[model samples]
Target: MRKKLIEAIKAAFLSEGYGFFQGFADKIQGSELTLPALWLTPIEVAGMSGRNDGKVTYKIVLYLFVQNEQYDEQQKEEKWEELERIARKGIATLPMISDVISTDKVTIKPDEFAFTSFGELSQTVTFLADVYFCNE
Candidate 1:
């Protein structure tokens, strides 16, 4: 699962012409920066109450470790927003699993973002997708 998620991310980056995986050989070379190890932290999932009504939603958190000094606060924020957009776009392209299940982006904090799923199959697919994309 992690492999798939990673692969998907790498593919997305490559598709966007970043080529970080291919250019550096052993490092991640962003368009305006570079890093030795751009660590993608473990993925996490949780269930929470929904806003529309009395319901539950599944949330998945995926983390990426950009070196502390690589980018300034403003740059980091901009990069985060870009990455979030990319992630959301990628998830939107995935086929629907069930009528009741839906996904959306959630903000955990200034530096943390989550892709949330609502409904019965939400947890299962979200977990599988996180692993799949992160690992592939």
Candidate 2:
């Protein structure tokens, strides 16, 4: 069920014309992914009050890591435009990926860029969604 949600996210972004980006559900190794890539995985699932088939709804935090190449500030405004576009599209794409069950609002927060173990500059955009997918 969680796996379906992950795939749905990638599918949504691709169908939304973000096919240029790569999506991952596990820890990426090396620098396998090119710039503007994304890593998505379930972090936690907490039970809530809503019931589904006698199961409790859940609040899930899906981690999204956006990897990118070094940004050259001696660049054009469109470069900035493009980055913002990616962020916006990423945020908009996940909410529509409620595969296992209906999902509530999705909240996304893109953190500052950090160097990954692979030495690539990446940003973490944590997406929050509430659904009815209990791990059981």
Candidate 3:
């Protein structure tokens, strides 16, 4: 079931002309990811009962990375604008996932390391997806 949800997310991002990865940035070894990428994987899964059908909640964090290439003042503004646009689109796309019963409001935080080492600006968006699975 988790794999099904992951594939659905990949397909949705692909349809939007974006690629979705299934793990964290630190986990990648030698592969170079294209800038403006999205990454997510289930960080936690909990089972709950006492409701209609038992529901499992998947705690997911979605990350978006944008290349912070050198740019003029005007271009800097454009870069920030592009980041905001992509983040908004990602938020809107979450609840549309199949079997997603609810999603909590999220806060997208900027990664501070962008100014130090990585020349790419990234944002982390976190939310929980509750899914009801019927007993077989």
Candidate 4:
């Protein structure tokens, strides 16, 4: 289920024209975290939605990773900001999600980000987009 949510978000990002990439844990075992070794990029534009109150709601959230060992604290912060900006730009360039209610952007320490579940993350996406995108 968690994997599915991650994939859904990745798909959403791809649909928005941003490259959705994933790096598997196995490939990061010994190599420096400086560069991503196992990355998965989505090939299509897609949206994930759930039905609520007789309506379909679409939303997405993404977890971007940067190697802490390779970047200083300031660099990590900058990278996150940059990534978020890029994500927003990507979304802005794409066709609007007529079904979305709202959207949100969150930044957390790497450890906190690592501990979040895919479902929880997905819920955040739903809430953010729904609150803003949905027109009551």
Query: Best lDDT goes to which candidate?
Result: 3
Sort all candidates by TM-score, best to worst: 3, 2, 4, 1
For model 1, how many clashes?
Answer: 18
For residues 23-117, what per-residue lDDT tens digits would candidate 1 score against the true structure? 22123222233332122334444443434443333334433323344566687677556555554554554323222244555442333321111
Q: Compared with the true structure, what per-residue lDDT tens digits does model 2 show for residues 36-66?
A: 4555544456555534433333444433334
Q: Note the residue pairs that clash in candidate 3.
A: none
Per-residue lDDT of candidate 3, residues 8-100 (tens digit):
566656665666766655654343567656777555785565455588887767676677777666876676667667666655665686666
Model 3: weakest 10-residue lDDT segment is 24-33
Error of 2 at 115 (Å): 3.2
RMSD of each: 13.2, 5.3, 3.2, 9.6
TM-score of model 2 (CA atoms): 0.53
Better of 2 and 3 by lDDT: 3
How many clashes show up in model 4?
15
lDDT per model vs. reference = 0.37, 0.48, 0.65, 0.38
lDDT score at residue 66, model 2, on the 0-100 scale: 41
Tell me model 2's lDDT, rounded to 2 decimals.
Answer: 0.48
What is the TM-score of each predicted model, taking all chains together?
0.34, 0.53, 0.74, 0.38
lDDT of 4 by residue, 15-73 (tens): 54544445443342333332211123222223444343332323343344433445656
